[model samples]
Target: MKFIGYQSLITIVCYLFFIFMSFWCIQDLHLERHLKMHEMQGKLLIVILSIVSGYLLSSFVLSLMDSLRDLIYIFKS
Candidate 1:
C-alpha cells in the first residue's frame, strides 16, 4: 500500500520534471520564422509539444524500469 503510493508520487514527479525540461529545451529554439500568425500561438504550440514529448519520454522510461524490475521475478522461486 505505502509502496504503491510512493510509486505514484515518483511517477508524478518524473512527469513534471521531464515536461519542465522539455519546455526549457524547446524555448531555446527560434521558431518565430515558422509561425505566420500571432506569437502566442507559437508559444502554445511549444507547450503542447513539450507535454506530448515529455509524457512519451517519461512513460518509456518508467515502463523500462518496471520491465527491468519484473525480470527479478523470473530469477526468483
Candidate 2:
C-alpha cells in the first residue's frame, strides 16, 4: 500500500480504539440519571458524547505526534 493508505489505516484503527475506550469508560458515568428524556434518548446522548470525546482526543494525539516528528526532522537536518 501507498503512504496515504497506511496513514488512513492508522487513522481508522486509532479512531476505532479510542471510540471503544470512550464508550466503555462513559458507561460507568451513568448519565442516564441526569437526563429527563426517554431511555432511548439517554442512550443516544451517551453515544454522541463518546464519539465526540473520542474523536477530539484521537485527533489531538495524532496531531501532537505528527508535530513532534516534524520538530525532530528540523533538528536533525
Candidate 3:
C-alpha cells in the first residue's frame, strides 16, 4: 500500500470542516425563533460558495506542492 501524503490528509480535513460548518449554521437557524426564508437561503448560498471555493483552492495548492516536490527530486538526482 502506498502512503497518502499530508496535503491530501489536510485537504480532506478542511472539506469535512466545511461540511460541519454548514450543518452548524442550519442548526442555528432551527434554534432561532421567527425564521425568515431569505435568511435561510442566504446562509445556504454562503455554504455552497465556500464549499466550491475551498475545493478549487485545495486542488490548486496540492498540485502546486506536488510539482515542487517533483522538481526537488529531479534536482537531487
Candidate 4:
C-alpha cells in the first residue's frame, strides 16, 4: 500500500486505541461516578478532543521519524 493509505490506517488504529484505553482506565479505576458527573456537566468534549489530539500527535511523531530517517540516510552518503 501507499504511504497515505498506511498513514490513514495508522491514524485510525491510534484513535481507536486511545478511545479504548480511556474507557478501560475509567472503568478500571471505578470512575463511573466522575464520568457521569462530567457527562452531566458536558465535559465529554474534552475526552473526544484528547483522543483526536493523541491521534494527531502520533501522526506528527511518525512524520518526524520519517524525516529523521531521511536525514540520517543523507548524512550516511
Candidate 5:
C-alpha cells in the first residue's frame, strides 16, 4: 500500500494508540463517577462526544492522506 509508507505507518500506529488511550480514559472516568444519575449522564455525554469527535477527525485525516497518495501516483505514472 503506497499510503502505508514508513512515516505514514508510524502515524497510523500513533493514531491507534491515541484512540486506545482515549477509550481507557473514558472507562476510568465512568468508573470514578458516583451513583448520582445526573453525574453519570453528564459524564457519558462528554465521553461520547470526545470519542465521536476523535473518530471524525481521524477519518478526515485518513481520507486526505488517501487523496494525496492517489494524486502522487497519478503524477508518477
Candidate 6:
C-alpha cells in the first residue's frame, strides 16, 4: 500500500469534519421545535455556507502544498 502524505491526510480530515459539522447543524435545526422559521432558515444557510467555505479553504491549502511538493521534486531531480 502507498503512503498518503500529510497534506492529503489533513485535507481529508478537514473535509470529514466539515461534513460532520454540517450534518450536526441540520439535525439540531430539525430537533429545535421553538426556533422561528426565519431564524432556522438563517442558521441553515450559515451552516451550509460555512461547510462550503471550509471545504474550499482546505482544497486551496492542499493544492498549494501539492504544487510546492512538485516544485521541490523537480528541483531535486
Q: Tell me the tens digit of each residue's lDDT in model 3 across 1-77.
A: 23567656776886676556555555454432444456667666656655776666666766776798789887787
lDDT of 6 by residue, 1-77 (tens): 23568656777897877666656655554533555456667667767766786677667767887798789877786
Taking the tens digit of each residue's C-alpha lDDT, what string does model 4 give over 1-77?
A: 59889878876786677666655554344343545655434345555555666666666766776798689878788
Number of clashing residue pairs, candidate 3: 0
Clashing pairs in 2: none
**How many pairs of residues in model 2 come into backbone collision?**
0
Rank list by TM-score: 1, 2, 6, 3, 5, 4
Question: Which stretches in model 1 have alpha-carbon errors above 4 Å?
Answer: none
Please report the candidate that would top TM-score against the real structure. Answer: 1
Candidate 3 residue 16 Cα shift, in angstroms, is 4.5
CA lDDT of each candidate?
Answer: 0.89, 0.86, 0.63, 0.63, 0.66, 0.67
lDDT value, residue 56 of candidate 5: 66
Off by over 4 Å in 3: 5-8, 14-37
Indicate whether candidate 1 or candidate 5 has the larger lDDT.
1
Between candidates 2 and 6, the TM-score winner:
2
Against the hidden true structure, what lDDT does model 6 obtain?
0.67
What shift in Å separates residue 51 of candidate 2 from its native position after superposition? Answer: 0.4
Candidate 5 at 76: error in angstroms? 1.5
- TM-score result, candidate 2: 0.89
Cα lDDT for residue 24, candidate 6: 66
The CA lDDT at 41 in model 3 is 70
Per-candidate TM equals 0.91, 0.89, 0.59, 0.46, 0.54, 0.60
lDDT of 2 by residue, 1-77 (tens): 59889889889988888888899999787787776677788788889988999999899888987898789877787
